[model samples]
Each structure stands twice: as C-alpha cells, then as structure tokens.
Target chain A: MHSFFGKQLPVAVAFFSGVLMIITFFSGDQTVADFSQEQLVWVTIVGGFSLLLGVASITRVSLSDVRKRRKGWPYKAVLLIFLVASSLGAIIEGTERGTLYDWLFQNMNAPMMSTMFSLLAFYIASAAYRAFRARTVEATILLITATIVMLGRVPLGELIYGKLPEITDWIMNYPNLSVQRGIIIGAALGAASMSLRIILGIERTYLGRQ
Target chain B: MNHDIVLFLEMTLAGFLTLCIFSFLYKDNPFYRLAEHIFAGLSAGYYVGLIWHSVIMQQLWVPITQNGQYSLILPGLLGVLMFTRLVDRLSFLSRVSIAFVVGNTAGISIIQQLHGFVLPQLGDTMSRFGQEFWGPLIILIGVVSTLIYFYFSKEHKGALGITAKVGTVFIMVSFGAHFGYTVMGRVSLLIGRVQFLFVDWVHSFNKIIN
Candidate 1:
C-alpha cells in the first residue's frame, strides 16, 4: 500500500499522462485531445507543487541557520527573505501589462542578472589563458577546426580566406554532427535508464534515505 | 561632448570591471568582493523579476483569469503544496511536489529528446558518409575506435590497439575545435566592447571625418 500510494502513484500518473500526450500528438480526436490537454495541465500543477519543495527547503534551512546564528547564515537569510517576499508579491499583485511585480522584475532583477551573466566573459578568458594547451594529436584537429570555424563565422573569415566558409561548413556538417549525435544518443540512453530505474522503484535515493 | 560623456562613462565602468577582474590575479580583495556582491544582488533581482513575469504570471495568473477560477484549482493546489517544505515536521509533504515535477518533466523531456536530439542527430550521422565518402568513413572509424579504447569491459590489443590509437586523434581534434571556438567567442566580446567604447561613446571617428 505504501509503495502504491506513496511512491508508485505519481509515477503511474506520469507514465499514463505521458502516453496520453503522445497519443494526442498523433490523434485527430478532439475529445481525446481535450483530455490530454487537461492531463498536461494537471502535470503542470503537479510540477509547480513540486517546485515549492525547493523553496520550502531553502526557507527551512536558511531560517534554521538564522535561528542558530551560524556563520554566513546571514546570506542564507537574505536569500530566503528575498525569495519569499518576491514570490508573495508576484502571486498577489502580478498582472499582464504592468504591476508592482513587473517593477520589481525590471528595476531590481534584470540589471543584477545581466551583471552576473557578464562575469562569464571574465571567467572564460582567465580559464582559457590558464587551461588551454594542446598536449596531443586530438588537440591539433580541434585547433584546426576551431580556427576555421572562428574565421568562417564572421565577415573577417571571407576577408582572410574566401574558402573558409565552405571548409568550415563541411567539417561542421560531417564529423562534428556525427560526433555530437553519438554523444547525445549516449547521454539520452543514460538518462532514460536512470529515469526507468526511478519509475520501477529500483532507484530510491530521492526518497532521502539509504 | 554629449557622446563623449556617455563614452567616458562606459569606458570608466569597463575599466573598473577589468580592474576588479585583475584583482583576482593578485588575491581576493575588497574591490573584487564589492564588485562580486553587487553583481550577485543585481543578477538575483533580475532572475526574480523574470520568474514573476514569465512563469508565475503566464502559467498561473493568466490561466486563472481567462479560463476562470474553477479551471485553475488543481494547479493552484499543487503550487501551494510546494510550500510544504517550510514545515519541518510536515516537510515530507514536499515529496508529493517533487514526485509530480520529476515525473512530468522526465516524461516531457523523453519525447522531446526523441524528436529534437535523436532524429536530427541520426539524420546528420547517416547523411555524413554520403557527403564525404572517405572523410566521414575515416572519422567514423576514428570515433568508434576511440570509444572502444575507453570501454573497459575487455582488453584492447593487436589490430584493435591501433584502431584505438587512431581514435585518440579524432578526440583530440574535437577538443581543439572546442577550445578554438571558445577563444574566438571571448575575443569577439572584447572586440565588441572596444568598438562600443571607440565608436558609440567617444566619437573619435567623427573628428577624423571632419
């Protein structure tokens, strides 16, 4: 009963819902399509509910740390406070065109996020200078391809060598695509295996117990 | 002068950011710390705003308002359940949310992966040999051999050993390609900033033209 209700229930619903959605994609039946849409909505609802766990967990941990007065607990508290306040504000006051939520979003959020994203430039540069080294045969091929692609992508490539585009495209379309596909397929199979294990109750680590 | 003022401002900010980045080379200092924190705050604010507008508003509010309250009940309930993590004793209630999210996301991702990742990738791989008969054949051999070399189930020796060695060549090329592309991207960004400083703000070219 515990397995059925506690663990299996959600998985069962998801599996069935997934099948239904797939069917709806292929089917012409309006009623069936409608049913699938509703099921998807239910799926979304379930997803949203699940996301709350993250927020709640964060809040719980941060609050606990705040109460205990642990080192660097203040940052956690600030984050928790920000999360809760923003969530609440958005939920209650949010509207389509403009709202206080929109103001908070534009004024407070966009600039900060863009600033953080900008850091990638500096980090990538430093890492490149420090870590980039060709130690083998494979590195040479990569170096050649990278140089060609870089030259080919912009107007500068044409200025440097008119044939760069043709060569770059050939490389990208042929070997690069093949290698990328192989990696992607391997990755998908791994993910599917992992998901299957979870659904079948073979994997229980997420249950938060050994 | 108006343009120069804006140019000066941009150059100043760019210079400051560059310095903050450089400071990391020496040691973690107050300047780097301040810049990092400010960036952190700004980015967090941006993300929070984005979530409010994009996810919360579009997914929740719009549906409830347009479709009517009854239609949104299930999703609303599920979303509320996400907050269950806040309660220490009842925190396990958050699992319901997790189950819903993980199940549906996995389900959706699997289907999307088949269409988006698998089909196109497969098509590309299959078409490669046709485009460059010998080139792709050699690359394919190299890729497969390298993968076999990495495989640990059995020993690679004799003729198989040579194939594995050749495979290493392909792998090195791939990494080199990746590195070169990354460097090119960073260089472009730096160039973009320089262009902005020179053309957009300073109007140095205007003086030359006059």
Candidate 2:
C-alpha cells in the first residue's frame, strides 16, 4: 500500500501527465488546452516553492555550522545574511525598475556571474593542453573536423582559404546536423523510458529515500 | 583628482581579485582562498535575490493578486505540503506534492520532446538526397556510423566495426571544432575584461599628458 500510494503514485502521475500533455497538443477542446496550460503554471509554482524548502534547509544547516564555529562558519553566516537580505529587499521593494534590488542585480550580480563564466576560458585551455591527444581513429577525425570548423568560423580562416566558408557550411549542414539530430532522438527515448520507470515506482531516487 | 582616486581604488581591488583567481594556475594559495570565499558569499546573496525577484515575485505574488486569489490557492497548498520534509511524522504527505510536480513536468517534457527533437530529425532524414547530393550523402554516412558506434550490444569486430570506427572519427572532429571555438570565446571574454579595466577605469595616454 505504501509503495503504491507513496512511490507509484508519482509514477502514475508522471505517466498520465506525459500522455495528457501529448494529447493536448492535438486536442481540439479549448477548455482542455486551457486547463493543461494552467496545470503547467501550477507545476511551476510548486517548483518555486521547492526553492523555499532549499532556503530553509540552507538556513538550518548554515546556522548550525556557525553555532559550532566550523572552518568556514563565517562564510556561511555571510551567505545566510545575503540570502535573507536580498530576499527581503526584493519582497518589500518589489522587483520593478530603479529599486535597490534591481540596482544590485544589474551592477553586482550580473558582472560577478559574467566574471565566473569568463573564468571557464582558463580552465578549458588548461584541460585541452593536458587532455587533447589523437591516440585513436576517432580522436584523429575529431582533431581534423575541429580544425576545419575553427578555421571556417573566423574571418582569418576565410582570408587564408577563400573556399573555407563553403566547406564549413557543408560540414555543419550535413554530418554535424544529422549526428546531432540522431543523438537528440535517442536521448528523448531514454528520457521517456526513465520517466516511465519513475512513475511505475521502478525508480525512486527523486523520492530521496528507500 | 578625487574621481581619479576613487577609480584607482576600485580598479586596484578588481585587478587584485582577478589575479588572486589566476594564481590558482600556479598552486592553491591563501589569496585564492580569500577570493574564493568572498565570491561564494557574494554569489549566494546575489542568486537568492535573483530567484526571489525573477521567479517568486513574478509567478506567485503577481498571479495571486492580478490573476485571482482562487487561482493561487491550490498551488499554495502544494507549496506548503513540500515543507512536510521538515516534519518527521508527516513527511509522507510530501509525496502528494512531489507526485503533482513530477507528473506535470514529465507531461510537458514528453510533448516538447516530440516537437523539438523528433519532428526536426524526421524532416532532415526524409529530405535526404536533397538539393545537393554530396551534402546529403555525407550526412547519411555520419548518421549511420554514429548510430553504429552507439550500438552497445554489438561487437565492432567486422565490417560493422569499421563503420563504427569511422563514426568515432566524425564525432571526434566535431568535438575538436567545438573546443577550439570555446577557446577563442574565452580569449575574447578576457580581452573584454581587460578593456573594461583599462578604458573605463583609467584615462587614455592623451588625457594623462594633458
């Protein structure tokens, strides 16, 4: 009974949701379509609420760490304060233009996030130098294709070889597009299978317990 | 002179922070640790604000009032149910909320899969021997070989193996191309940061001479 209600119930919901959504795409009924759209919004709202659960968990864990004076307790305290302050600011001031919350978002958050993203360049370069090697048939092909694409993408390559643009277009349109498409199809099938397993209670990792 | 001093201070601090991160290449050091901890705190605070403003405010508060209180009631209930994770005795109730969330997500994913993945690929495959035969032929080979390479149940010892080997080449070339492009992108990002530091934060040589 527990398995059926607790675990399988999610699975059943997953299965039915999938089927209904698929049907709604082709369904003629306006009411059915509207209901499906609203249901999706509700699901999104529920997901938003899950964030609160996360915030709550973070608060509990970080406060405990601070109380214990763990190695990074001060940092945790800073994080908690930031989280609470930002959340409260947004709620009270609202997120409209010219608000303090919006200003912080534009100046501090965007630049910092962009900085972190840009840091990836250094990491990727280091990784490539250490890892990229043409040890096998596949690796060799990859190396060659990568070279062509790189050359074709930039104006320098075209200047070096006037025909580079035509060749790059050919590679991207044919082989690249086809292989990417096949992978997409295969992955979709795999996802469907996994969703089915979860709905049926054959998979329960999401439940976060045995 | 006053504005110059303020700019100098901000520029100095930003430069120091950037270098602290770069120091990671040499080895993990105290400077790196300090910078990392500071970034972690700032980013957490920023993200919490983002989630509150972009998601919670837009999806929940506006909808509750602008749309109707009735519209938000069920979602609120479901959101509250997620907090069952906190209560040891009533944790089972959380499953109801999870089921709804999972079910709705699975449903949308299934529909999107067909639209976004299946149809696009089918169009490509069906359009084979298209306007350009050479382009279509290469794509055909790429699709076939990549599929064979991914066929895990079979052994690649015969003619089938050779084809799979060929497929691996194509995939590798594609990856190499992607890697090179990524490197170039990172270099550009670094350049952008340097430009901002130099141009925005400091005067040109002409202004200094004046």
Candidates in order have lDDT scores of 0.59, 0.70
lDDT of 1 at B30: 66
C-alpha RMSD by candidate, in order: 5.5, 3.5
Candidate that would win on lDDT: 2
Best by TM-score: 2
Q: Report clashes for each candidate as comma-separated counts.
A: 17, 4
Assess candidate 2 and give its TM-score to the true structure. Answer: 0.85
In candidate 2, what fraction of native interface contacts survive? 0.48
Q: What's the TM-score of chain B for every model shown?
A: 0.72, 0.77
Model 2 regions more than 4 Å off: A1-5, A199-201, B1-20, B29-31, B50-58, B62-67, B86-90, B203-210
lDDT score for candidate 2 against the true structure: 0.70
lDDT of 1 by residue, A92-194 (tens): 7763346654544443444334444445567777875676556655655666777788788778899999998887777665566545545676676667666
Each model's DockQ? 0.28, 0.47
- In terms of DockQ, the best-performing candidate is 2
**How would you encode candidate 2's per-residue C-alpha lDDT over A1-210 as one tens digit per residue?**
766656666566666666667679889999989888887877877887776776677677878999999987876776666566666677788766776666555544444445656777778778767877788767777777767877888899999999987888877776677677667777876777776665555766776674
